[model samples]
Target: MSTFFRSSLRSFATTAKSAHHNNHRDNHKFLPPTSFLGSWEAPKDPKEAEAKLAQLRRDYAKQVKELRKEYIEEMELMRLEKQRKDEARREALRVATEERKRLKAQEAEIRAQQRNIEQQQFRETLLKERAEKLEYWRRKVKMHEEKKAEKNELLRRQSSMWVDEAEIEKQILDTVIATTHF
Candidate 1:
């Protein structure tokens, strides 16, 4: 395992050195960014190498923690925005439903009022028809009474017997009472 690791590091160092030399020769304006991992080498002193490794580990851990905290804060803000939108949508829906109900109730009231008006008009028409029928009957009765009175006067004159107004009124009253019994 140690041999494999050393071989890999040697190859990486050789590649980096070649790239660096090429950059200088070409007079490049910019060099490629270096990674911390590629810069690390095994020190001759084991203790110094261990200390260096530990420091690098600490830096990497701190960077990871900071990124995680930022991600959590951004997620919390997004969640709050979503919740606010949902609440607004629900409120709008509730208001719309209430408005629909109000309109329906108003329409029902209008229909009821129209029905009442129609019923009243129908009743008035029936009363008018009844009044017309009663008037017709009254005219017919008056004509019959006039004819009976003329007949009675003619009969009395023929008999040479004159009936007084009180007697005529009594006879008319009796005729009215007799007709009412039927």
Candidate 2:
């Protein structure tokens, strides 16, 4: 397992080195911008190598801490921006909804007014039709009364006349009492 790990690490290091030499931006996240060794070469002495390795470890740790803090600050700013945008969107939606409601209410009022006008017109029309019908019936009643009067006059003239071989006469119709027998 150790051999496998070491081999993988060696391959990663070679690839990183080559990518760096080629100035490839793809490996920039994995590799630190500043060299931790600071141009130091490996010493033949084991004690010197151990000291250098410890120093490299401290430098790597410090870089990671700084990067983590910067990342946290950027994430906080991003979160604040998202919250502000959400609040603005909500406010816009509320305003738009209020405007829509106001317009809808106004439209309803207009419709009610129109309905009132139509109802008033309908009432006026109904009254006019009723008056026309009443006038027609009044004329019919007057004509009926005139016909009945003519018939009564003819009957009065016929009733007062005496049928005789020598004379035909009609008396004036003065009262209804004289025209009937009790």
Best by TM-score: 1
lDDT for each candidate structure? 0.93, 0.87
Per residue, candidate 1 scores C-alpha lDDT tens digits across 1-182 of 99999999999999999999998989967766877647878799989998998998898899999999999999999999999999999999999999999999999999999999999999999999999999999999999999999998898788677667899899999999999999
Cα lDDT of model 2 by residue, 8-56, tens digit: 9999999999979778665456756675346778799999999988998
Q: Estimated TM-score per prediction?
A: 0.59, 0.57
Candidate 1 lDDT score relative to the true structure: 0.93
lDDT at residue 122 of model 2 (Cα atoms): 100
lDDT of 2 at 26: 57
Give me the displacement of residue 170 in model 2, in angstroms: 15
- Per-residue error for 99 in candidate 1, Å, reads 1.7
